[model samples]
Target chain A: MLRQLISANMNSLLRHFLILTAMLVSSGLFAQSGGEDFMRSMGKMYVVVAVIVAIFIGIVLFLIFLDKRLTKLENQIKENGKAR
Target chain B: MVKHWWKILGVALLIFAFTAGLLTPIRPGINDIQPTAVVAGQTVSLTLTGYNTDFNQEQAPKVILWKDGDHIINALGVSVLNSRQVQATFQLPTAFPLDEINELKVSTSDPANGFITALPRLRISGMEKGGEAAASAWTGTIENTDSKGGFTFPYLPNIYESVRNTFYHVALWFAMFTLFTLGVIASIRYLLTRNVMFEQRAVSYTSVGILFGILGLITGAIWAQYTWNKAWSWDIKQTMTAIVLLIYGAYFVLRISFEDSDQKARISAVYNIFAFASIIPLLYVIPRITESLHPGGQGNPAFSRGDLDNNVRMIFYPAIIGWILLGLWMAQLNFRMMKIKERLLENEY
Candidate 1:
């Protein structure tokens, strides 16, 4: 039973890794393909890009917090409601 | 009192400011002219480009030329090239008291629709004249100062369309200052009461404030490019601001370097206070006293009342409020998350 559960966890982790990698690769591809010229065409309005970045950063930070919360909850359940 | 009412309000204000700030139209003003210098008794075709002004050649809008507030050389009639550009043929008074500098202004007849109030003084540099002064068209005439116009940003000579950057650049600075103040307050509270929650809050505020400061710098550089003709003008104010940002960066470094929770809180809080204190002189005070390209510089266009007109101020003030509220909301979320992490770590130990 312990071996089977470990295999299942590893599979899920691998799947998550693949998905995140795909997302990063696709975004990098999009940026590499004419994103620079596209942004420059708009009167060098790079300020808009900066604003978008700040928003995405806030969202990413929040997601990180949520991820931590989920990990903590999962650990608690595994420990049968005990911290250590 | 962790109420979310203000957070919602802040978001709403930001939405309005963003939409209204972009949507608001600027009034008509001269953007350019050809042949900056002029000799007496010459027919010059002056081409003028306006921001959002409509010009009708049939209306015969007059281009008033003032020579150092004493002489007048009124152009004959405005020939409208399009809504944005127009031309006028000016017959220089053969002999007016010659001066080294002269100014040319243009406006339409509609009093309700005011024209560029001030500051875009198209200088007409005078050349050495050989002949005598002829009976000129620019005789004694009443210069119109009061023109009723729709709301518009002040048309500056160099800062043409980039005036829109005001919402992003100026408001971000305001927001950064507000967030930093809150951070300093939270740090003091932590030092006084030894509350871990306050320390977390202080960290969040400082982080968000630093984010704003970074945004301010980026947007300011963008504006400086078009107006000052350089990305980094080496202005004292901008250099000081960069230094202040680095100092705040050190505050975060101090926070993470200390592994002990209590020591991190105590030391980082002190550093945060010092960082905030330094911003006053570096960002605001020294910039005003020194010769910089910023608004407060000596003999700068900022001394004029044309920086933020009533229309811009309407949207700008709200933008400040929105950005600050958003920063506060982010800081609050960050604190909550860090607090949870702190609890989990404590449980582990």
Candidate 2:
């Protein structure tokens, strides 16, 4: 049941992530003009975007590491229970 | 639901902070002025570039060159080049009222965009030796223009809109500090009671705190890259923070090296206490004492009235609280997982 709930959460998280990426890409294309770099063009607003992305990725990776550790512990418990 | 109210509040505060931080408009400011230096006795045309300014408004901007509180020279003529640019002609007096003052402040005030001053002082050359009579050459009063009444972020020259990063980058450090404080408390408790539960809590909190410190460094580096033109300049604050992280990194290495669980917990608990003690001097005291590029160096307070006005404080305080609560929540999860693993090992025995 816990596994089911986690998968459901992951599915929604994936959907939201894809939507955010699509919006950013579309906005970047529209905001581009002349010879200036796309991110640098809009008053360097993309610097803020870059900072937010770095933070989000850091938190997500930390979560993934925690999830992997939990998975290993869960496997150890399952093996112990079957042996008994 | 009552037990989880703080969690809900954390998420809500973060959503509000993120939205408000991004959506607010920045107040108008003069970004640059061309022909930084002017001859004392000549008519010179100077071009002013502005950020978030509307120069083409119906009410034209009033430009002034100010030497001191009592002396100011109004622009002889002003022409709008575009919304963000203006050309103003100023007739300089043969001598400044104050002979020692070589730099003049340039300011522009318009009703639509409010008042903004150029960051760089204008240099004046070829001025004759002056007496009290030179004060007569200065005419006109600096106009008192009301700021456009609304909530807006203050404009900083190099920082510009990225001043919004104050919410994320600075708040991350605040959150990290809170976590490390909690970790040290747990470490002290473990030493007193010899309880493994407190040890687990300490480990969880320190791990999450380190994660946050890393995030803070990455975000700060990104901000510095554009504003300071370098991602890593070995700034004093940067060097101090790196040392703090390395000190805590050794805590984890020490934890893994000990084969006995009890010895591991007791020894790491003592090390954690020392690590926490080092933070105050490394992050706070040394940075202020040293000549540093980061704000708050050389005995100046980091969050002065100028650096964090009421407008920024609104979102900034909430961001700190939200990040702290979220970090605590992560630590709680890690602690629970550790407890479960311990239980599974006991059952195997």
Candidate 3:
């Protein structure tokens, strides 16, 4: 009897999985054939933005680092002048 | 006491008005309604939903539904299915010959009964007259028929309705802008007259602005995680907002890092000026130019989109104004408290 109940549960789970898979496939097909061009345009937009941001961030960080170094050097010079 | 008579009256009036507005439940609702879903040979279902009873509990509300200002469905068709069920669907006429905007109006309550009087409304679009053909064509264009089917922008993508966070996230920045604007004015006054009181005002506003900014970033990250599949995608807007925040955070650091009162005041004032200047572009300009997942991106129109109808604008504009005023009120109180502390210290000295 336990074996029969376990098989019944497994069969129901399999049926549910099949239904979900069918729905996904149908939706996926609709999206692929009709949605490709639009998705590509959008993907291109995101990639372009990501690249620009990466470059800008790099430059900003470089400037910040350069400023820190220059500030340190300026402080050292002021200290030297005081000593003299 | 005679000199302060106006002040006393003003306080009493303010208290009375606030209490009344709070007590008056003007929560909008739909009464009797009819909707025609099938106008112009279309097979679309129309449903109307809203709260039923008035806030005053005066009487069961009644509504009359009209098509093109013609009474098609009378108040009798407005059946209460379930006392709490707020939605009603109706079948549309096979052919609707209207050219202009179709309006839905919930009529005013019975004025004799002393209930709140107002007509809540919903609008049916003109394009619906052309039927499903027009709607399908419209959705097809918006969904983008090119590579990778459907709309490309994540914000518009069906998966990312989560982008409504744009209002809350962006609203926080607007609040920050407001507080910082106040800070700038206070800073200028401090510089002009060497008033430490003005300096304290500036500091208090900036502190609140920073708090709002941080909360904005956190909310933004939470929203980003749902749409971007990660908490921090480093989009241009995100990066810029973070940078703007850090710049102001630096102002606080500069103030605490120095012990000399004059030096702290001068340096912090200068830094605040720079922070405010950078914020305008960081929050407004660069995000538009760079690839942005945020709304108002290269392709996404920020302000004028079909999604945000006049109905949304009604609530949204008031919400922005209310939040900004609330921020200002809090900042003003902070300034007053700081002033009291300063006065106490002076007394001791």
Candidate 4:
């Protein structure tokens, strides 16, 4: 029963992907008709900026987490020295 | 020493690429204006102006007037009239009824290649009100068009050039955000471990972040003036940016407010986290919902792939990379300098 349910869900996901692909192709053709290419270019530019920001933020978050861990270890070392 | 050498090389390469990118004779595509409407059976004249690069004369522009993509009038071999001016005149079709649609394109072929540069514009405006009738009839070669079409793509270069300032302004904010995030993390660690080094790092990052935040605000203010007709408008984006600066500004005040070092660090760290929380709503959330004249304002067209053309992308992408790398270099120096300063203070006392 579980296997059957998983198969059904995968089928639905695949169908959705195909529909999205179709929509994208149709819109691209529509944009080409006007020859303006403004909207399409704007989307790409937005994604580029978004990606840059996301990566920068992700790296910073990771470094912050690392700093926290390192500080914890250093404190443990100090406590050990006091006990010794 | 090796790391220092690599850093120096990185800075030098960034400078070289940036300079080369700026100096390259790329066409900053100008803006073209379209006429909103026109009346039938009335005579109208169309006027157009050309904006060229550093070497305008080299490109002999050919202005073509079209009705629904069909060529109506063509002017070619246009030369520089006096210094930087290229004049052309065209008469609107009297036969087309009111609300007739038409387009005007100004093109210049590359002297190097046969490929033409066509900056297509719309010309759908109506005839002017009671004018000197005689002034309308004369459609001669080498004459200017009287029909008041809106400013062409020529006005766009100034706007596009302003985007370069984004590198400096946005870079400062990016660096500031990075540093402040570090400060907040260190503060949190200090709470858990009660380590002084963690506290020191937190203080250093906050200080550096504030410095960058101030620089970002200054550059953004100057840029806003030329682009928006005012240095500081009460626009949501501008206002929010100012608020972010203020929040960080208060971080300093909160630090100095308390004399005890431990108390200052603890309070300031809490404030740093709070300031960062506000950053999300102010810079990201608020700007999207509020009305703004800035590009990508609420309900306004945001910058995306569709908006940035090859002409824009040629300069914009390299600019982002160059600016980010430069920011990293500066942050590294700031972080190192901060360490030395703290060490000096420790020894002196």
Candidate fnat values, all: 0.05, 0.56, 0.00, 0.00
lDDT of 1 at B137: 48
lDDT of 3 by residue, B52-146 (tens): 23222233333333442342332333333443222323333333334343554334233222222123344455423554433322221111112
The lDDT of each candidate is 0.66, 0.83, 0.50, 0.50
lDDT of 2 by residue, B217-320 (tens): 87787777667767789998898998999899889868766768899999999999999999999998988788877766677525534788689999999999
Error of 1 at B241 (Å): 2.2
- The local lDDT score (0 to 100) that residue B30 gets in candidate 1 is 58
- Once fitted onto the true fold, the runs of candidate 1 whose alpha carbons sit more than 4 angstroms away are A1-84, B67-73, B97-137, B140-148, B298-305
lDDT, candidate 3, residue B286? Answer: 78
Winner on TM-score between 1 and 4 is: 1
Once fitted onto the true fold, the runs of candidate 4 whose alpha carbons sit more than 4 angstroms away are A1-84, B26-47, B53-60, B67-83, B89-99, B102-122, B125-160, B299-349
Name the candidate that leads on lDDT: 2
Off by over 4 Å in 3: A1-84, B1-167, B299-304
**Candidate 3 residue-wise lDDT at B129:** 52
TM-score of 3: 0.46
Tens-digit lDDT track of model 1 for B111-214: 33343423345555454332335324446343555554555565556554456667767788888889999999999999999998888988898888876776
lDDT of 2 at B56: 81
